[model samples]
Target: MLLLVAAVGILAVVGFVTFLKLSPQSTPISSQPSTSTKEVNALSLYHWWTSPGESAAINSLFGVFKNSYPDVAIIPAPVSGGAGFQIFPLIQSLVNAGEAPDAFQMHAGYEARPYYDAGLLEPIDALWQSEKLESVIPKVIRDMTQFDNHYYSIPVNVHRVNVVWYNQKLLKQNGIDASRLTTWDSFFAACDKLKAAGVKYPIQMGPTWTASHIFEQILASQGVSFYENFINGKILSAQDPTLNQALTTFKKFLSHVNPDNSTTVKDWDDAIRRIIKAEGAFSIMGDWANGEFKLIGMKHNTDYGTIPVPGTNDMYGLCIDTFQHPKAASHPTNSDRWLKVVASKAGQDAFNPIKGSIPARTDADVSLYDDYQKGAISDFNKSTYMYPSIVHGSGMPSSFKLKLNDIVDNFVQTQDINKAAVAIVNQIQSTLPEFTKVWSLE
Candidate 1:
């Protein structure tokens, strides 16, 4: 609680700080849109995907959207930092000022709750029915789009959150049997073997957000029922054994990670680079990191490979990315057009393959996707249990998640399991009122 209060205080004193986002194909800092501005033949799209692979993927979708509607220009304003961390507050300010973009990147599920609760977003139920999405998109994904009995967002791609990416060559050289590492205990034993063989940092991680991400993976590996309660705001007590146990496991995970902080690793991609260079053995990042590996010409199952964050093997951890319609959109028609392309089979096929995610629509052409994505599609189909990701903003309130970043970061430094568990429970209690959306992920 003190952590958030102190953060709010700093923001109040310094005023709003906007990060510098420079791009040849981006909106300049001087020309940020205003609510009362007249609608042009342009669609202002706000997102936070500025990385090499991420940028290419979004641009591919832009090309698809353009082929159909070349008249409607796309103004890409990508605010890049900490994944979505730096963009969230800026978007909040814009939305509060009624300057919301025509359409912006929104993670499906509770991440879109505040907008829908405040009635700032327009539901797209008509599109769902017209496009026959009900039959094409999976039920779990469809449910993620709906809140208060209306669909508010259109998911473009789905990322598996519980993936543990590692250098396959390193494990083979170390004589560790990768196939047998099916549970956390066995996984840690492999790490132990690597450590004994002079691999100082068996795991590589970057920044606080990455730490929170791996922590969520550990929590999800606790099983679907416990994780479902976690996202639904049901983990209310600090004494909850499962919660505590997860924190303990996360502590062990941090011990194996690189000693360098952000200055050294910088971001999640850097950690994957460490694995590629054989400086580290593993990285617990989403499949987005696969895009980076591919960008560098690394082949799957040869140079690197992934397994479900140990103990989460048949489970598909959800990190769905969607676009929403704002009630005060400047170019309403363009927004609708963008949503259509986002939901289209062609657009998804172009975007997700380069983006390292599976199309939300189950009927996508699998041949366009690589082996990792093909396998992900198979896993998405077989998994009856889908867990929402906390670090990625698909689960819990924004308040809870903001506070959680600090708690987990502190735990990484202190390795204090009990303290992290208590702090997390307290933050959950304080943010209970904000958790109005009830998730039915069983």
Candidate 2:
């Protein structure tokens, strides 16, 4: 029953790191390209942004950097995977071999933990002070970028996770008021109506990770404090009534999703497309799906609309993209220059519009953003609280995050609430020691 979602997480670590480096075609790039040497001459960048929207979004930033550094060649080295699954492992290999790129893309919070712990990254607190970013960027975001009281990365964009994307026409045709469907009880009641009206699957879902992604949102709906304890490894019992309640809720939610036997989605976007085709009424996805809607010439609030995932109206589930300079970067000065460009208001403005996320900078140029983004920006500015997303690798450790997708997948196929609940607790208990950072979201 568990569905409604978010993605871009693949903290899919270690096991695949070796294989990716061994395969030449899979290896994204070397630190020094044998093309440019000086710090200002060229820069090798490693990131996982190979998709159409993501590529163009990054290109916009490239354009900004090019305008300023007219002589320096910007060598892009993007890995082809969602959320740096292949790229992070490759970085591990590159750093070990003394071939780390000048800079690389990383998620804001816990994703940087392993790198910082291993002495693989360099802190840039001085840059923050020089640019006076402390006064502009939100404190919570700044806190996420720091380790032991120092800044290490610059957040470029913020993707809200607690988003419900619905086809406006589909809901209207079904006589379901999405605004009224703001609680699980009402959501399921609407699902019942859709099913009775021959809408077999009222909710669309995708691969395993989407289910895990949905599970995180469901858990967060309990409360920010509950989610904080969860990420900090506190929920460790199937007997905990609230934990089981969340599991039960997920099961109920999955019931509304398209059954795997008759139909299956290729990925998150495929599920989103189902809503566009009127094959489904809802999809819980990140705002990036808005980019897809915009690309197809769909209008916000007319063709599609978004609400915070039920019960999250006052909160923002933050999944941020940040950039950092590595310790042994091939071009340190060029890497420094790249970080400067990424931190600039111009870089965030150009990248976030295409990226379908709001700019990380507080004073964003509103005119450049679309209706959906403008709403998100407003929600972000005044949200009750913001929590890092586990599905997107900002909340939990890699070990637990990787196992979560399988756990959610198994639970969906089996619909075994007790088993899933037990599995979730057991995994947390085992991985508790790995969850070092004490997140104070609430």
* Clashes found in each candidate (C-alpha, N, C closer than 3 A): 0, 4
Worst 10 residues of 1 by lDDT: 1-10
Task: Give candidate 2's error at residue 325 in angstroms.
Answer: 0.4
Q: All candidates' TM-scores?
A: 0.89, 0.88
lDDT of 1 by residue, 1-442 (tens): 0011111122121232322222344433212346676445667777878778898899999999999998765666676665476655666666676566678888887777766766678989998888888898988889889887899999999999889898989999999877788888898899999999999999999988898888888888898888888877789889999998898888777778888955687788788888989998989888888788888888999888888888888788889999988876756878888999999999999999999999999899999999899999899888877788888887888778878889888987898877888898888878888877676667
Where is model 1 more than 4 Å wrong at Cα?
1-39, 96-98, 440-442
Error (Å) of candidate 1 at residue 211 is: 0.7
